[model samples]
Target: MGYSPSIYKFVEGSDTPVPLDMDVVRAVLSPYDIGDPNLTVMDDGRLQCWVRAADGSEAEIFVDEVGILVERPHSGPGVFAIVAELASRLGAAVLDPSSGVFFCSREAHACLPVDMRKDVIVIEMTGEGVRAALIG
Candidate 1:
């Protein structure tokens, strides 16, 4: 019923590795049959995507060159899985901008440069739900 904070592709603030583009998005989501995803020409000019997580919950992601702009995160832990997958594949860490919480797939966390000992919240997806730790 309510909205979650906007998520972002981050590698320490605005220093993301590469600018995200529609072409790459299309490639990544191709397996899902999302089909030629394009940006909505609204004020934000974001590419909207509807993704269904393995658990059957769906989420709407609005992305641009800067990464996720607005998220209509429907609900459930599945949305986090969606974000983790994107982060892992994109080679970037996910950030909940408002909370300053960083997220990365467990598979990729060890390789991240987020100063894992800096005492920030980092979350990883687990089969049961999620795992959180105070690390940057």
Candidate 2:
């Protein structure tokens, strides 16, 4: 499960983004540890999972022809689904989105413009989970 204390920070409210790699990102993920690891694409048009974990959440990863554009967890049942949907629309990945908190990869941050990222609030992750209402 993606649970790293250093990965997140709690400010006035909302989750702040920190620099993290795909491997470290994969390691902290809760779903992957269980066996339901999120899928990553290979060059040959085949499928290779990054980290496997367990969860009833079902979904698949899709990629555009080029290989740079990735669409993963196409659909699923959970908070992650909302994230996937949003990312799909934005052509990005769900780096972090728990309740009121919304942390994204540095790439994703750049994908979104400065104005948009500025609007996002920062909240600290808590044991109970992020409080979604803070954003509103």
Candidate 3:
């Protein structure tokens, strides 16, 4: 089976639930400075693009309300590395080494309330494969 992307709150030592916000997410991701050639902002604000690996394989990357999702069916281990690279670029800390659960940097996390940071939202790409959301 292909890897299904899952979103989780990265806040450390806090149990408060906070809903993902696109603007806050944007701020956290600003450091990546994702350029036009590598990334594109859709009309609805979601980001769609491909992240190329050193081996020349590319993984599909989408960022929305549900969180950042990466899918690279045939790319193998490089796909996870791409996810880790993206998270690092966003200044987010990887909470789970296995799943690559990342939390926005402490500075960015302050923008949202503790309560809003609850469940991890796993976005399901539909059959049409057109639906996507963004954090900011």
Candidate 4:
């Protein structure tokens, strides 16, 4: 099986992880064509998904009270762009639990080669967020 890395993204720079509105995420992610035909929040109160635009890679992007979770086969540039934009707008960072990295900005994610992308990196948060360090 593939690594199928799952990463969480959170808005930073606050004492608490900012809550993510599933509706906002739904609105922002409209372009991705995530396999949710109805765009309805599931009974679990999260978005369940599969990515059709990424060569049928089984992927999911969901939000909870604290943040967003993304599970995918691997990193794709197109997907990264969308996520990066989301992060940029929200002052968030993608946290890769597998590897202690926080992709600080959209450019950070864009520069990393796809095959080398095990996960997202962390950034520094002030009022909101930005993660740019590696953790053990």
Which candidate, 2 or 4, has the higher TM-score? 4
> lDDT by residue for model 3 over 81-113, one digit each (tens)?
454444434433323234444344344354334
Off by over 4 Å in 2: 1-20, 29-41, 44-55, 58-114, 126-136
Q: Give TM per candidate.
A: 0.58, 0.29, 0.45, 0.58
RMSD of 3: 10.4
lDDT of each: 0.51, 0.33, 0.44, 0.49
How do all the candidates rank in terms of lDDT, highest first?
Answer: 1, 4, 3, 2
**Collision count of model 1:** 0
Better TM-score candidate (2, 3): 3
Model 2, span 12-95: residue lDDT tens: 232343222344333334344333455454687543343221434432333333121222332223434333332333333232
Superposed model 1: Cα runs more than 4 Å off = 5-17, 21-23, 30-45, 105-136
Listed per model in order, the count of residue pairs whose N, CA or C atoms clash below 3 Å is 0, 26, 17, 15
The TM-score ranking, best first, is: 4, 1, 3, 2
Measured on C-alpha atoms, candidate 4 has an lDDT of: 0.49
Poorest lDDT segment (10 consecutive residues) of candidate 3:
127-136
**How much does candidate 2 score in TM-score?**
0.29
Estimate the lDDT of model 3.
0.44
Report the Cα lDDT for residue 42, model 2.
66
**Candidate 3, superposed: residue stretches over 4 Å from native:** 12-38, 88-136
User: Which has the better lDDT: candidate 1, or candidate 2?
Assistant: 1
Off by over 4 Å in 4: 1-12, 21-23, 54-58, 106-136
Assess the local accuracy of residue 93 in candidate 2 as a C-alpha lDDT between 0 and 100. 26
